[model samples]
Target: MNGDWLAEGRAELAAERILDAVRMLFVEKGASAVGMAEVAETAGCSRATLYRYFDNRQALYVAFAGREARQLIERVWLNRSINSEAGRADQLLDAIASVLAEVRKTPHLAVWFEPANSGIVAQLSNSSDVIDAIGAGFVAGYRPALTDSAARLLGQWMIRVVVSLLTLPGGGEDEERAMLRNFVMPFLLDDTTTIE
Candidate 1:
């Protein structure tokens, strides 16, 4: 049992090291341009070894994206600045804005948001269950009244909004906020919901 545990720990460490290499590549090159051979070379592992850890480049990207998404979600969860006491509409808006801010703050993740690469990232996000679940969690955080399916649908919409902004940002932060308020908030929030 101890040997098995040790083996698992070692495997996890190796995977993390590989992911770290991939992240550095993402920072150096655009996310859409990174390849598996480059990652394996950067990671100082043979192709077979890299393949053992990640079946293909897409799989590797998914793994890396999942890690980054979870980190972003955790950071948002721990953020003290997010006004939990605000109305549900405000809270949802804040949460979505926070996600954009966090992604922008990390250059490695921000590379994926660039216009040239945003389409690839958006496609990957659409297929990523991890991102969907995180979005659902974000929605459910502020609006517990929503059913799981409703929250997920709202979450998916929120993801689309984020991707749209990342691909084509507004005039400025204020403009972005206005876009969210006028365009997004009304559609997501009910008429009875008050925005404070």
Candidate 2:
């Protein structure tokens, strides 16, 4: 049992190292352009070793994105201040702003949002179970009465809004906030709204 635990720990560390190396390459070159052999060389590991951790480039990208998403969510929640008396809309607006700021400021994350790479980022994010769960958790927090399916749908919509903004920013923060408040909040917060 002890040896098994140790081996598991080592495996996780190796995977993390590979991910770290990949982040740099992503920043230097868009994510779609990166390949497994380059990742192996950058990580200082053989291609076989790299494949042992991640079966293919897609697997590695998913792992990296999932890890980053979790960390980003944690950081956004930790640093954001929510006024207990504020309306749900206000709280959600704050959360969105925090997330946008966090991702924009983080170099590794910002790269993924660049126009050249945004399509890949969107595809991965929309398909990722991890991201969907995180987004659903946000929906549940604001509207606890929603069914799981409804919340999940709304959560995905919220993610799409964020991605759209990141891919092509609005006039400024004020404009962005207004767009969310005027356009998104109505459809998003309306209990009677049905998503198909």
Candidate 3:
């Protein structure tokens, strides 16, 4: 048991180091340009060693995106703020807007939404169960009355909206807020709920 634990720890550490190398390359060259061999060299590990951890470049990209997504979720969740006067609909809108602002501020993450890379990032996010679950949790927390299926669907839609905004931001914060409020809030929250 002790040996197994130690091996697992070592393995996780190696993978983390590899991911750190990848982050540097991503910031320098953009995510699309990174390759496994370049990552291996940057990590000071053999290609064989890198491949053992991640089967290919796509796997590595997914792993990195997954890690960043988790961090982004945590950061947004931790800093979530809802005014007492704000209704449930307003609260949900706030959460969605918060995610967009945070990602834009985070350079490492924001790069994924660059014009050249946005499509790929969107595809990865759609396919990632982790990303979907985070979105679902956000919706379920706000709307406990929703059925599982309904919450899941809403969550997927919320994530897509975030991706869309990231890929192509509105003219300004006012425009973005209007888009969310006028278009998304109605579908997400009942008419009985107050906007403020």
Candidate 4:
């Protein structure tokens, strides 16, 4: 009751609504079709209020992608039990499949994840600090033997491959994922090691 709980509560609600609207907008319209006003209206707030939270469309877009990536990775990590499941490629595969499949469902997010989606949203690709943070989070627990660049590149490539699968003409998720484990496993994960 002491910390201006009323204002804080209102602010939290507004932020959540705006973020949710932004995410939905991204899913429905990609980057070009949606604007701050649309996002504000979708959030059921005024554009002036939305601007108070985010400086510009790009910043909100970045926040939206960042939030999505965090949630996706958290889900994957929880499902795979990545911390406790040691040396289990199958579990890792399950986790990755879930993440990719979910991402594939969101066309705008998926499109942005691709290198080519750079045209839609700047932060979805290499230009995004949010993505870099996500990459850092992924590599944080990785074995020290794998250089930072290697770990980041491996993760980025895996994401790209799956996104490509989603947008590509024919190949299915299973095939691409299977091929990934086959070729990339040697460098990133050892067979006998258990992560969980």
Per-residue lDDT of model 3, residues 43-137, tens digit only: 87888888989998878887887788788878776466443545766776777788899988877777788998876787787777777777777
In candidate 3, which residue ranges exceed 4 Å CA deviation?
Answer: 1-8, 79-86, 191-196
lDDT digits (tens) for residues 135-186 of candidate 2: 8887767677788988998899888889899889989999999998899887
Query: By TM-score, is 1 or 4 better?
Result: 1
Using lDDT as the measure, the top candidate is: 2
Angstrom error at residue 119, model 1: 2.9
Q: Which segments of model 2 are wrong by more than 4 Å?
A: 1-8, 78-85, 194-196
Model 2: how far residue 70 lies from native, Å: 0.6
**How far does residue 120 in candidate 3 sit from its true spot (Å)?**
1.2
Q: Model 1 compared with the native: what TM-score?
A: 0.84
TM-score of each: 0.84, 0.88, 0.85, 0.71
Q: Report the candidate with higher TM-score, 2 versus 3.
A: 2
RMSD to truth, every model: 4.6, 3.6, 4.7, 5.6
Clash pairs, candidate 2, are none
Q: Which stretches of candidate 1 lie over 4 Å from their true place?
A: 1-8, 78-87, 191-196
Instruction: Record all residue pairs in model 4 with backbone atoms less than 3 Å apart, i.e. clashing.
Output: 84-196, 85-195, 85-196, 86-194, 86-195, 86-196, 87-193, 87-194, 87-195
Q: How does candidate 4 score on lDDT? A: 0.64
